[model samples]
Target: MSPALALEDLAVERGGRRLLHGLNLTLMPGQAAVLTGPNGAGKTSLLRTIAGLQRPAAGRVRCQPDAIAYAGHADGVKSALTVSENLRFWAAVFGGDQIAPALAAMDLSALGDRLAGRLSAGQRRRLGLARLAVTGRPVWVLDEPTVSLDSRSADLFRAMLAAHLAGGGAAIIATHLDLGIEALRLELSEFAAPRDAAPLSGFDAAFA
Candidate 1:
């Protein structure tokens, strides 16, 4: 089978400084990928480029747009909406009824009627993760997915991820903590950032 996604010599630059360069990575169905690096290491920027939220300065990104789901640090939840309402909206966007199961998996089933704005930080993150499950996309690009999640919630998130992989889905996660999920490792330095650079596009070559 063809790879789910491929990044060939992808490069990215931001604020006139190089964030990533010559970064090559491949994600296959059922496999998980982790972008492990310290702050300012370009992990989020790399994921953003793959998700088409940002453009590479030089190389190219190739993937099936409909088969990918991208989530950033911001859950993007409407505080005024109820849990069920928030997921209902997402189901509309992804065109499916998978949100119910996602909500249950994230432990949000009981909070379906609760306003998202009133949710705790961890609760919000769980709702955000529920989208990944409901989208049923082949690849998931997540940035700090477990950031505000409490220990139990974080564990639940990891379990959901394992189930996702078992179902032939893949993930590319930019996180500071080890989710303990089986995954390939990719470091931004492997892409070779330019010294004293800005503008976020200098690392586009890795996307080729």
Candidate 2:
């Protein structure tokens, strides 16, 4: 079978700094890769590149269009909407019909009717992860997925990820917490580039 995702000599730049270069990876169905690096090491930049939210200065990201479901550091939830409605909205956007399973996978069924703004940080994070399940995509690109999750919610995430892999999905996770699952441990230090000063920021950076 073909690989679920591939990075060919992937070079990524952020804030005028070349963060990653000549990085290569291949993730097959049912496999996972954990990105490990300290702050400023470009882990988020790499994942954002894979998610098509950023452009690499060079190299290639190989995956089917719409194959990736990305969950970044931000919860990306609509605070005014109820938990269930948030998932339904994402499902509609992604053309998926499995909102119920997404809710159950995140242990969110009980909180379905509650407004997202009323949820605790952990609950909000779970709601963010649930969005991934509703995408019906084969590849999950997650950055800090367990950020605010408590033990139970974290376990729910782990279980959900296991199920995704068992069903022939792929995952690329950047996390410091131990998920207790066997995954290819990928470190980004070797591919790092040092910066002389803090890189660009705000409109000056964006418009440059």
Candidate 3:
């Protein structure tokens, strides 16, 4: 079987300046990769490029269509929607029907009826992550997925990721904190552009 995701000599740029170049990696079923680097090292850029949210400057990123479910630094929860409502909406968008399972997996069953805006930061983060379970996609691209999560919630996330991999799913996570899950580490700094590269400015600096 083919790998779930592949990047070949891929290059990403921000502010008309290259941030990452000549990057190559492959993720197979039941595998995960954790991207680590200082801020502006292109970790987010790589994930965004893979998720098809941003175009790469060169080379290729290959994956099955609709295979990626991405969770960015910001929680994608609707403040007005209840926990259950948020999960249900995502399930419908992603062609999944796993709301109950997702809620249970994220340890959010008890908060089902609570409006998202009323939840604490950790709870909101959990709800954001629950969307991944409902996506039913084989490939996950998450940026700082554990941010704002307490130790227990982080542990829960590790367990969820492990289960997903065991079930033949793959994940690419960009996080500064240790995930407590077995995954190959990719240091984004190694792929950084040369010091002589043009400095990012204006709108491009936003991505940096």
Candidate 4:
């Protein structure tokens, strides 16, 4: 099968500074990849570039932006909406009717009626993760997905991830925690951009 996502000689930059360069990677359907890196290793920036949240400095990402369901640092939920409503809103946007399944998967069924603003940190994170389910995208690219999750909540996340993979979806997770799943480990720091590297120019400069 063709890769769900592919990066060919990809370069990522943040704030006019190159972070990673000449990076080659591919994520196939029904598989997962974990980005292993230090704080300044450019994991988040690469993910943002793949998610189309940021423009890459050079090279190419071989996937449509819409095909990626990105869960970033922000919860991206409306505080006014309840747990179920939050999922419903995302479902409406992404053309899915799986809010109920998402709620159950994230262990948010018990808080279906609770406003997002009322949830604790862990609850909010779980709710954020649930957005991935309702997105209806083929690829899941998450950043620090289990930030505030406790043991049980982490287990729930693992089950949901496994379910996604089993159903032919792909995941690229940037995390430090061992979610107890086997995935290709991409050590981002290995591709650190050279300090003396010049920024992209001409045509590419426009997007940089």
lDDT of each: 0.83, 0.89, 0.89, 0.89
Worst 10 residues of 1 by lDDT: 199-208
At residue 30, candidate 3 shows an lDDT of 92
Separate clash counts for every candidate: 28, 0, 1, 0
Candidate 4: give the clashing pairs: none
lDDT of 3 by residue, 24-72 (tens): 9999999899998888898887898899887788899999998999999
- What lDDT is obtained when candidate 2 is compared to the true structure? 0.89
lDDT per residue (tens digit) for residues 1-208 in model 1: 8788888888776655677877777788889888877788888778888888878866877777688799897897999899998898888888887677898899999999999999988899899889787776889889989899889999999899898888888889988778887899887666757676444434443452
Candidate 1 Cα lDDT to native? 0.83
lDDT (tens digit, per residue) of candidate 4 on 1-208: 8899999999998767788998998888888999998899999989999998777788888975589999999989889989899999899999877788899998889899999999999999999999998888999999999999998999999999999999999999998899788799999889998887787654445655
When 1 and 2 are scored with TM-score, the better candidate is 2
Off by over 4 Å in 1: 196-208
What local lDDT does model 3 show for residue 72?
98
On TM-score, who's better, 2 or 3?
Answer: 3
What is the C-alpha lDDT profile of model 2 across 35-149, one tens digit per residue? 9988989899899999999877678999988899999988889999999999999999998767889889988899999999999999999999999888889999999899998
| Superposition error at 74 for model 4 (Å) | 0.3
